[model samples]
Target: MTGGAVRPEGPRASERAARPDGALMIEARSISYAYKETVALRDVSFGLPKGETLAVVGPSGCGKTTLLSLIAGLMPSTAGQLRVDGAPVQPRRPGTALILQDYGLLPWKTVRENVALGLRIRGMKPDAADQALREVGIADLAGRWPHQLSGGQKQRVAIARSLALGPDLLLMDEPFSALDALTREEMQDLLLSIWRRHRTSLVLVTHSITEAVYLGQQIMVLSPRPGQVVGLFRNPTVGDRRAAAFHEMVNRVRDALEKGVNGGA
Candidate 1:
């Protein structure tokens, strides 16, 4: 896939992957948020090492998605320090991409156009879009309109768009929630493959416990509204769902989630 991805060529991807030289990729300290009177998140602190994946899981309205926005620099935190790549968060920082739950595609754009959109904005060769589409196994669907694709196909286009931009920090807010079970599994496997190859820092917010355990090397659980960090689990065996202890980790996360609901309420 020789194309217009930034970060330069040659030894860069290795340098990026080797960036875990004792520095965190993401750091949040005493992060809090409120909408005038309605508090959403409170004192949430966490650190994500470079090239690792984190999954945030909690009940609805726990500010899980809001946390992603904060990390993406979409909005400032109400209080505390938040940094990414050792710098203060900035809106739409280069090499940082957010994938929304709703697919976020322009209805009028073909799959190819949608994939090329972010690249063009970044001054990259939009022609490289085809390579991204092929990466996600959707190059054949490039000419099709969004409405013509199935839910899973639409999600593929969305993933291709972000991959096209060659993001270093990938934040996904329930990217697979809209898909059926089989398709969701397929997409999950595809994402694991991509992560293995690219080694990007990933943060995913989802409601599914199984999904969290499957993908997150680090799993964070937030409490209900006025969210707080209630639990954080380390899953060394991430991506191996058939492992003997995989279900055990899921149960632990489930228990922590219930604790959040009961104590938070």
Candidate 2:
């Protein structure tokens, strides 16, 4: 599932290192969403600093995915504002990219072709598309179909495709939830490595507190249905996932989620 290569535009520097002063990249001001009679989000507001990873965690049906959709412009908000780089986000924009839980690779296409699909859709040449595959380290599996690759391989391809676009903002929706423990860890490490190479602001939604702590410089815990941000924690000493401080932050987030589910916090 490798993505095709793009000409690599936008800001330079590794994604995490690029935000020296921590300027805002994505902003949600009093954002709310509803479906028919059901309220999905309620006055959820947060700011994602450029080149930083912000992980959203909450119980099932907490509108985590809906929030991502709003940020990605997959759907319109019923109220409030959603912005990217200070401007309203538009779906399929060059400045942002999305990676779904399912990988979303076309079964009929080979790994290379699937990776290149985005660029091809954007009207890029074949040569440039091939280069994107190489950037994601799936060049060897370029000709293989999605069914032929392992779960981790498929995820790598999905990520490669996203990176090939050189997006300033990257949205991920429980991307590793479907994989086994070992594979999920591998994917996490791979993602950190890639983020180091390309400095994209990341907004990842997940149920795992541990996963959130491992990847995010900042973590936001949302309450149950009609989601609202209940708690926020920042880890200044990121990258040391095993540190006591990191574990403490993880426990705090987990407690917040449990409290939110039980209507305590």
Candidate 3:
């Protein structure tokens, strides 16, 4: 269930050593997507280094989820290039996992079954799935159905489902937006802890300013409607979410968002 080994001659392996400790996990260049006559994204470009977290923030209907879908290999770009683990992403790429806002669990499935779904799809046993549930602190509730779980518990199941696959890259679409404040904070802490332990590359799409600054090592700001990369802010306090430095970074991201939404390039 690992991301597998990287061959010396493989796409990113040639200069993997020279490229910094964590090489690029995802690279998008001049990417664009359209739904019929409406353009969703345009000229969006960014590179996420391995083991880092990237947060994408933008106004509503700005194609944030669309970008995540593209990276997750759910769909292809209408124009430009998208690569995951240095290879062109295609449908169901093993190195990527996506956690949607709705949890995406089958209502009739028990918690354990839901978590085991992805692993089963990859032809792996349910061992990793059980391990994932334990990691998320829900091993005791594995038999509970989705209807029997609270919002936070359901989200944990979603996270565990993704983690069970051991994906090198995890794509999350506002996974905490629906939780209550206290629950959301708890989930955020859980995510940070899991991220520190797993060191998996993460890209989260969120509209919350505070959440973006707290979780993202790099915050990418996008414009309205026809989304584009208006700015990309690198956070200095990667794990110090409550520090003064973290607040400063948040202000910087907020300013960038304002400028970008106000028509800055």
Candidate 4:
């Protein structure tokens, strides 16, 4: 008890205190990868809380897609670790799913069949599979084939298929990036509605700042190649997309992204 003075923990301690309870739904810690000598990710770390939507945004070749691939277990990271709900992610896990921009629907399968594929694999009853199609608002199109549907319809089917499986986490890679502005907005709304009902955690990788702001409770901005989290923004004003507060948050994210691009932050 001489003269030693105890010091309080600082900002990092406060940051840790703010984390959510329960195991993270998904975690990427010190995740790094390389294609030969070209680095893809460098010490990138982030976590998704249960029922939260975390959006990842960055410039081209910034490892956003690579991160998604790693999370989906399509490819292993060259270094670091990835976990899905406290367990190490494997090459494939029934608890997670991915939706790509192209929809990835099987052309030969009818809408209902396509949406039911996951359930079918899991041995769900045929009627239950039909119910999943209805849940996604595509029941009427159940008999239609992929080629017979519009782009938005096809994407909905893809989403329906993913939801039917009731996965704990959904990974989407620019799923709406190719749609027209109106369709994109519609798809975003549909996605949020489904997520609200299902309460599944989502991790979406996109290049659009507005999309990220519209969909994510928290947005993570990554630096160029060998991507790292350059910025993080949390939008406390959930929903009410038309509200001025929502627009303000969107602008904030947009400005931060612009600055990151210009300053290489």
- The digit string of per-residue lDDT tens for model 4 on 127-219 reads 665766777787899999999998889889988888878788999999998888999899898987787667688889998877887778777
Q: What does candidate 2 score on TM?
A: 0.90
Top candidate, metric TM-score: 1
Which stretch of 10 consecutive residues in model 4 shows the poorest summed lDDT? 1-10
**140-234: candidate 2 lDDT, tens digit per residue:** 99999999999989998998887767688899999999899999988888887777667678889999998888888778888899998877776
Q: For model 2, how many clashes?
A: 8
TM-score of every candidate: 0.91, 0.90, 0.90, 0.88
What is the descending lDDT order?
1, 3, 2, 4
Candidate 3 lDDT score at position 56? 88
Separately for all candidates shown, the number of backbone clashes (residues 3 or more apart, or on different chains) is: 0, 8, 0, 0
What lDDT would each prediction earn against the true structure?
A: 0.86, 0.80, 0.84, 0.78
Query: What's the lDDT of the predicted structure labeled candidate 3?
Result: 0.84
lDDT of 1 at 167: 89
Off by over 4 Å in 1: 1-19
Error of 2 at 45 (Å): 0.8
- Return whichever of 2 and 4 wins on lDDT: 2
For residues 1-265, write the lDDT of model 1, one tens digit per residue.
1111012111234434554555678888888999899999999888887787889999999899999999999899999999998899999798899999999999999999999999888888997789889998989998999999999999989999999888899999999998999999999999988987888889999999999998887888988998998888777557778877788989999988998899935
Error of 1 at 37 (Å): 0.5
